[model samples]
Target: MNFGREAMMTSDIECDVRSLGDSGKQRAIFAHFDSLSVGQSLVLVNNRPIEHLRDAFDAEYAGSYSWQELEPRPRSWRVRIGKTASDALPRVVGHTSSGDLDRRSAVWSLPIQRRHDLDVTIVTLAPGTSTTPRPGPAVDTLVHVLAGTGTVTTELRDLDLDPGTLLWLPRHTPRSYTAGPDGLRYLRVRPHQQSPVPDSDGPW
Candidate 1:
């Protein structure tokens, strides 16, 4: 199997394969993103047919997999896999509005005694306004367009984003987004980062 940085970025983030039984039956796990652009795509493997694990968690922005047991012994047969675009299109779960943005996110993974490893959220922007630009603590972020059109004006540059576009923002970059006349809807994926604690004697 051949994998690359670019391929992984646009394709599904993870995969699982296992043998079913002595009859040679095989099972596979597959996940698809809503859109694909410079940083992401609806992940497909060289035209290989895969079935989604139903028990997996579906969040507002991203999906997650449950822990699955693997076969103890490795299969003798050789299997080759390649990266290619998927012919299947993505199905929309629903649209989210700015008012319900924070509460609408679905938690995919929860760790005991620690913060979550990943957090996914869907944000919708109404026409004629923009969100305040703010810096995240320290985590990488991936944004994918779901519906409508918009212009993302960042400190670095202005980018026109429509359906099927993805953007990757490094940790701590100050950024904001605004929607076009029709409004905008997109998914945001980011690693969990704790906020900094303010000193008792803060500066005015």
Candidate 2:
């Protein structure tokens, strides 16, 4: 498998939350954790007991992740959280909204378990942001809005989007998206096994 330069070069990420406020700390840690790839791990350094985070992590990732308390310090605690190398059985994967972390014009995240047959992504677009028009992938796509609103422009027409809106885009259709004033967060799913678009010249 192609582990990619990212996962190969950054095997361990350190998240220091000692200086952040109570509420900000968990978000910071989780953001770092969410960015990790298989075989990569996060080293969390904090000022308080982080045993509670273990329960939170267990509740989110359970069998697909590992946690180990490192050597204790006088005032700091450290724990190594790793995404396990083993594959998980078919099961429910939990995820909340991207919320404040998806602050960029556009951002996307995959659920913990990435399956070979499907490419599932949570996409967030900041207010007034838009995705450049491009020919859709070779595989069919299903997009479901989870929050906010947007307009999806396809070859045929512009479709308005709202929370709970679900759209189907057939393979090879040209499409783009523009976020509403409130911004947009949606789920995009495609069949990973389908052949990709032939051209590789477009922006990523």
Highest TM-score: which candidate? 2
Q: Which regions of candidate 2 are displaced past 4 Å?
A: 1-87, 90-94, 105-108, 111-115, 194-204
> Which pairs in model 1 have colliding backbones?
12-43, 36-40, 36-41
Please give the lDDT score for candidate 1: 0.46
Q: How close is candidate 1 to the true structure, as a TM-score?
A: 0.42
Q: In candidate 1, what are the lDDT values of residues 26-50, reduced to their tens digit?
A: 2232223323222333222222222
**The candidate that achieves the highest lDDT relative to the unseen native structure:** 2
- Candidate 2 on 1-204: residue-level lDDT in tens? 222122222577888888988888878987787777888888777776765777776655668888766735646677778888443435655464755423433245443322246666777777888888898777788988988888998888999999999899888889888888888888778766434445321221
Q: Could you tally the backbone clashes for each prediction? A: 3, 0
| Model 1 lDDT-worst window of ten | 64-73
lDDT of each: 0.46, 0.70
TM-scores, all models, native as reference: 0.42, 0.50
